[model samples]
Target: MNRERIIAIVAQARAGQATDEELQELADALDRDADGSVTSAMEESLQQGRQQIALPGREKADRMLADILETGQVLEDPGEEAETPAVIAPLKPGWKRYGRAVAAAAAILLLAGATYFLLRQSPRPEEAPVAGTNPLAPAAEGLPAGKKAVLTLANGATVMLDEQHNDTITRQGNTSIVKKEDGRLAYQPGNAAATGLALRNKVSTPRGGQYQVDLADGSRVWLNAASSLLFPVDFSGHERVVELDGEAYFEVAPDNSRPFMVKAGQTTVQVLGTHFSVSAYSDETLQKTTLLEGKIKVLAGNTGYQLQPGQQVVFDKIRAGSKLVPQANTEEAVAWKNGYFQFSGADATVLLREISRWYNIEVVFNGIPAGYELSGKIDRSIRLSSIVTALREGGVHCTLEDNRLIVNK
Candidate 1:
C-alpha cells in the first residue's frame, strides 16, 4: 500500500497488464488511505505517462472516459465493494488505446470511492423527496441541441431549417433565402435593388436548437440555443443593424461606408468588421460582449468604450453599469460556439441556466450553497445524464425528475 506500489499498479493498469488481484489491492489502498497519498500516486503516474507517451488532449480524453462509462463495464454497482478491475481485457491497439484505458482507469479509481461514500450517506428530511417526486426514478436523458431554427420572412412567413430542408427556401424582394448544402441559411441577392428595403427578417432558435445565418451583406451569424437575430433581408441603409436576443457569435462583413451594429438588451456593439460574441440572456443579470478579432466600440446607455482583440465588456442589467475587461478569456467566452461548456470558477446558478437552455429542461433549485463555484469543460454533445453525473461528482447534489433538474444543497 505504499506510494511506489500504488504508482506501479496504476502504470500496470495503464499498460493493460494489471492483474485482477493487483487492481483490487489498489482499490483497497485507495479506500484505506485518507491522507490523499493513494490519489496523489495515481495522479503522479498519470502525469508521468502523459509526459512519456503521446496521448490525446483533455477533451478527447474526457470523451474516451465517457465512452467507457457508457458501456457500463468500467465501474461496479454502487452497492458492491469498489474493487472492480480497471482494465478487464488487454488493449488491442498501441499507445493510443493504452492512453484511453489509462484515462478511464484513473477516473474510475478516483471517483469510485468518493461517489460510493456520498451515496451511502443518509439524506436529510428536507433533501428527501423533491416535490413528492420519486428521487430514485430513472429520469429520461436529454439529447443535445442540433441544427434547428425557423426563419421568418419580411411578411411573417416562416421556413423551418434542418437537414431535410435545402435549396431556395423563399424569395424576399431581391434576396433569395437558401439553405446551403452545409445546413446553413444564406441570403443570396439577385440583380436589382431589394423592393422591401425597410422590411426585416428574423431567424430564431428554440430551446435545444442552434443555427447559422449568412447575411446578404456576407456577414455570418451563429445563434445559440433559445436565441434570435432580426435583420433586414438586404443591407441598403447607411448602417447595417441587427437586433439580437439571448446569445450569438458574429463575423461582420467589412463595409467602411456602413458600420455593422448589433443591439442586445441595453448594449450596442458597432464594428466595421470584427469577430465577436454577445450574450444577453434575459434571465441572466450580466450581458457580456467579447471581442476575438478586430476593433469595436461598445455603447451602453450614454457611455461608450472601445474594445480590442481579446477584450470583453460586461454590462450589468440591474445596475445599468459596464466594466471593460482588458485581458479576457476569449476562449471561455466562445466555448459554446466551439462545441463545449468551459467554466472557470462559474457560479452554480450560472451553470444551471446554461444547462437549462441547451437541454431544454426546467431547473428547480431547492437550495444552492452560497459561494459555490465550478471549474471544468464538458462536451456539449453528451447526454443530460452524463452532465448530471458530472454535477454529482463535483459535489453538487442534484437529480433529474422527468424534464426538471432539481438541485439541492
Candidate 2:
C-alpha cells in the first residue's frame, strides 16, 4: 500500500481495534508490495509498538522535550553549572533515533517476515511468462474447430466425412468406401471395374479419437487419440501405405503383392503388412517407430536400417547417434490405441508436451526442473489439473504461471 494507508493501518493496529477486513487487506497489500514474509497482523503488531513510544530522533522542532530522572547525588545538583548528557536513549526508540533507522528496521522486518511466511505457505514456485510470442491463438482462429480430410478415387470421386455427421458417407468408385453410422469406416471392391483402381482413402477423427478402414488389402489400422491416418482404400500400383500424426498403430494385412509403407515425419517405414506403431508429432524432436510382428525398413534419406520384431528406431533430431534402441514393453508403445497414456520415465517437458496436444492447450516452461522423470499409465480422459496434481505428488512439482506451466528446479 501507499505510505498514508500503511500509517493509518499502523495507527488502528496500535489502538488494538483493527477490523478483520482491514487486517486482511493489509496482509494482501504487504504480500504484494513488500516481497517479504511478514503477514499483515504480525507487521501491524510491530508497527503498533513503534507508534506507542515517542522518543525524539529526527528533530521535528528545534526545542524538544526530553525525559530526565535525576537522583540527588551531589549537594548542589547543578542549579546553574550542571552539564549532564543532553540526549537520553528512550526505552523504545520511536522518535529518539532518526527516521532512517526506523524505516530501515521496518524494511528488514518486512523481508524476514515474508521469507518465513512464504516457506510455511507451500512448495509451489511462482509462475513466470513465456518469451517470444503465442502461436496457438492465431492458429486456432485460422483453422476450423474440426477439419475435413477426404479420399479421392482414381475415377475422380471424393468422399468427405472427417467431422460430425448423422448419416453414412460414401465415395463413388469401382471400390466404394463407406463410413457407417456406427463410426466404422470400410471399403468394398466394386464389380464395375474389371481392373482394381488406385484409391486414396483418408480417415480422420476429431479431438477425442477415431478409426479407419484400409479395405480388403487385409490391412487394418487403428488411429489413436487426436490422430489421423491417410491411406489407400486398396493396395494398388507401387505399395500399400499410410501417413500419420499424433499416434497410430497398424496391423497390416500380410500383402505379399505389395510392400506396406508408413510415413511419419521425415522417416519412412516399409513393411509387408505387419503390426507396428509410429508416433511422429511435429512438435516432438524424436520420430519413433516400433515393429511388433514383422520386419520393416526405417529409412531417413539414404541411411536405412532393417528392424526386426521387438526393435525400435528413435530418430533424434537434436543430437548425434540417432541410434535405434530395443523396444520396451511393447504394450506401452501402443497404449494410446487402447486409450491410455503410457509414460516410461518421461521428463516433465516431455509429459507436458504430450498433455498439451491431447488437451489442446499451449505449454510454456517457467524454469528448469529438478530433472525428475515420470513413468505411469493413465487414462487420457482425466482432467488436466488432476494429472498435474498426480505428477506433483510424485515429486515433480509444477504451477500455472501466466499462461505457461512452470516446473520447479
Candidate 3:
C-alpha cells in the first residue's frame, strides 16, 4: 500500500469517518508491510491530524484505553448492544505488526469514539467473562519493582535498603556501607589497618525488587529481582570473588594482579576487567553469561569458553553441556538492567517466568500452546495490569487475578 493511502485511512479513522472496509484495508496493509512502513505512516498521519480532531483529554483517553483493554471490547453507546462477529479466529503469527495495529486502532477508537473494529482476533469463547469475575481486573494492582533489598552483615544482622532510608547504613570492618542518595548501596573503604577477618556480606533483592551495589573494589553490580550477591566487605586476598544466586550485571574494576570471579551454580565467570551479565536462576534450565565489553572466560564443568564482546555462553544444567553464541542479543540479555523487558523470539513460558519474578506473582498456565513465541519490548516501569495488556496484545491470552497470573489458550 502507498503511504498516501495509509495516511488518508488513518486520518479518516481518527476523524470517526472510516468505513468497516477501510478499517479492514488498514489491517491488511499493516500485516503486509512487515518493515513497519504502514504503521509509521499511520502514526505520522495520526500526529498530523491530531489538532484537527476534537479528542478527549489525556487522562480521559488513558481511561478509555484502559477500559477497552480490560474489557476486550469497545465502549458501547448509552444503551446500545455490542455486536459479536460470528467467527473469532486466532491471531496471526507476526506480533510486532499486530501490536502496532492494536495501538493504532486503540488510539483511533479512544480518540474519536468511532465504530468498533477488530484489528485482530478476539478472545476465545472459553475466555469469556465469568460471573462475578473480571479477568483483567486484579484484586490489587501489582506495582512495578523498585529499589528494595536487604543487606545482611557478617554478624547476621540485616538492614533494609530502600528509597526511604539513606546515608551510612552500617560499618563492616574497614568498609563503611552507605546508601547513596540515588538509591544505590556503596561500600566506602577506609584507610584503617587490617581487621580480624574479611567478613562476607550479602545483598539480596526479593521478588518485585532490584538493587545496585558499588563494591569496595570499585566494581558495580546490578541485581535483578529475586537475586543476591555474596561478597566480602573488602576485596582482600588474591582475587575478588562474588557468589551469585540469580541474575546480575557486573562492571568489574581492572586489577591486573587480581581477577574478578563470579560463581553462579557450577558455572564460573572469570575476568580481569570487563562488563558482563550472568543469569543463573535455579529455576531456569539454562545458565547464560553474556559479555558486553572486554573479555571473560566461562568455566562450565571441565570445559572453558572465552567470550568476547557481543558474545554469550549458555550452559545447560540438565544436559550438562555448554554452547557459545557468536552473535548474541546483548540488549535482551541486559534489558532488566536497562529498565525494560526486551523479548526476542521468547516463548510464552519464558516471558511469563520473567513477569512472575518481577511482579512477584504466581502464574498458572492452562493449555497454552507449546510453540507460542513473541518478540516485543515493554517498559518495566509500568504496572502489572499494563504489562498484562501488552501480553494480550502480543497474542498471549492472560489475566491478572490478585497476585496470580492465569494464562489461557
Candidate 4:
C-alpha cells in the first residue's frame, strides 16, 4: 500500500467507516511492522491520555517506530498499556454467521503503516534467490543448492561437476565420461578389452544439490540432493549392479540377459528394465522402493516383495522386514525429479528432513510440532520462509535463526 492509501484507511478506521477488507489489510500490515509490539512512545502517550488522538499521518507512525528499536522486538502488544484501542465498528450482517471475526480498528493504523514500510524496504521474493546462490532469510546465510555433484573416479580422483561442460570429464576404462548439453553425465562405452575397465565411479550430490547421469547401458539415473550412486563405467557381468546411499530415480535399460540390481542399505532392489525410485536415507527408518513402470523385486534377508507398476516396497532397515503397498502414489515419489516437494499427509520429521537437505539448514525441534500430518506440494526454488510460514499455518510455531530452524509447539 502507498502512503496516501494507508492514511486514507486510517482515516476511515478512526471514523468507523472502513470496509472489512481495508481494516484487515491494515491489521496485516501492522503484524508485519517493527516487531509488532507496543512502542515506548505509544505507552507513554497512552498514560498521558492527553495524547489519545490517533496518529494523523505517516510522520506520526514514523516517530512511533523509532521508539520501538530501543526496547527490542517482540510479537506481543502492550494492549491497554499502550495508546487507546482503536474502536472497531460492528461487522456487516452475515459476517459473524460465517464464523469469521473482524479485528478491532485500533490496530489497523499500526498494521497499515508497517506493511507499507516493509513492502517498500524489502526486496520482493522474485529478486531474492539468484541461480546457484543461497536465498536465505535475513536471519540466515546460505545459498540454496543447485543441480551439481561430485564424480569420484575409479582411480580415487574426484571431479566437481557444477554444470554441463559439453566435453569429456574423464575416461574410465573404454568408457568416455562426458557431460552432455542437457546437464547430464553420459558414459560412452568402447571395447573394454582394448581400453581396460574401471571398477566403479561414484556420483554424489551435496545437500541442496542434485544431478543426473546416463549409464553405458542407456540407463538413466536422477540423484536427489544428499544422495550417491556407485556404478561401473560399463556393465559386462551376468548382472548390472549399483549401490545407492540416499535417494534416486532410475530408468533401467532393458537387458533380459542381465538383471539390474540396486543395493540400498541391507535391502537389494532387482529389476530387469523398469522405472522406479528408491529412498534409503540413513536418517530414515524405512527404505522405500516405488515402481512407476514395469516390475521390480525388493529382497532383504529371506523376505522378498514383488512390486507391480504403481506399487511400492517398504523395507524396514532395523527389522529387515518388507511390505507391499499395492497402489502407490508414483507422482509424489518422483516429484523431486520434476522439481517439487509433494507430500500427502506426510510426517513433519519426513517433510522437514527433505526441506533441510534442499535448504542446507539445520532443524532442531524444541517440542513436537502441532500438525502430525500435512498434504501439500511446493516448488523447490521457494525460499525457506515460505515453508516455515506454511508450517505456522498448520499450528506449528517455528523460528528461523542463524543457520538453524527451531520448531516449537
Candidate 3, residues 1-409, lDDT tens digits: the string is: 7999988986775556888688667766755766768767865665576456444333344444444434433232222323211111124556444555544444444444422222233333344444676666746467879889999999999888874367898888899999998999999889986474879999999999999999999999999999999999997788998999999999999999999999999799999999999999998998999999999999986789999899999999999998999999897899888776665556668768898899889999897646665444445766677566555554566777888888877
Best to worst by TM-score, what's the order?
3, 1, 4, 2
Q: Model 2: what TM-score?
A: 0.56
Residue pairs in steric clash, candidate 3? none
lDDT per residue as tens, model 4, 129-239: 224533335767444568789999888899889854789987777889999888889999876463435479999999889999999899999999999999988887888
- Whole-model Cα lDDT of every candidate shown, in order: 0.72, 0.52, 0.74, 0.66
Candidate 1, position 163, lDDT: 43
Judge candidate 4 at residue 385 and give its lDDT: 65
Considering summed lDDT, which 10 consecutive residues are worst modelled in model 1?
114-123
**Runs in model 1 with CA error above 4 Å?**
1-139
TM per prediction: 0.74, 0.56, 0.77, 0.66
Query: What digit string (tens of lDDT, one per residue) describes model 1 on residues 1-409?
Result: 7888877876775555677688777755545545556656766766665566533233333333344334412222223232222111111122122333333343544333222111111222333334765543465578879999988888888777764467788788888989988899999989997675587999999999999999999999999999999999898888999999999999999999999999999999999999999999999999999999999999976679999999999999889888999999887898899776765557778978898999899999888645554444455776777667655644566888888988877
For candidate 1, the per-residue lDDT at 25 reads 77
For model 2, state the Cα shift of residue 397 in Å. Answer: 4.1
lDDT, candidate 2, 262-348, per-residue tens: 887778999886888888776678878888898889985446889888888888766623567775457667766654555544665
Best by lDDT: 3
> Local error of candidate 4 at 132, Å?
31
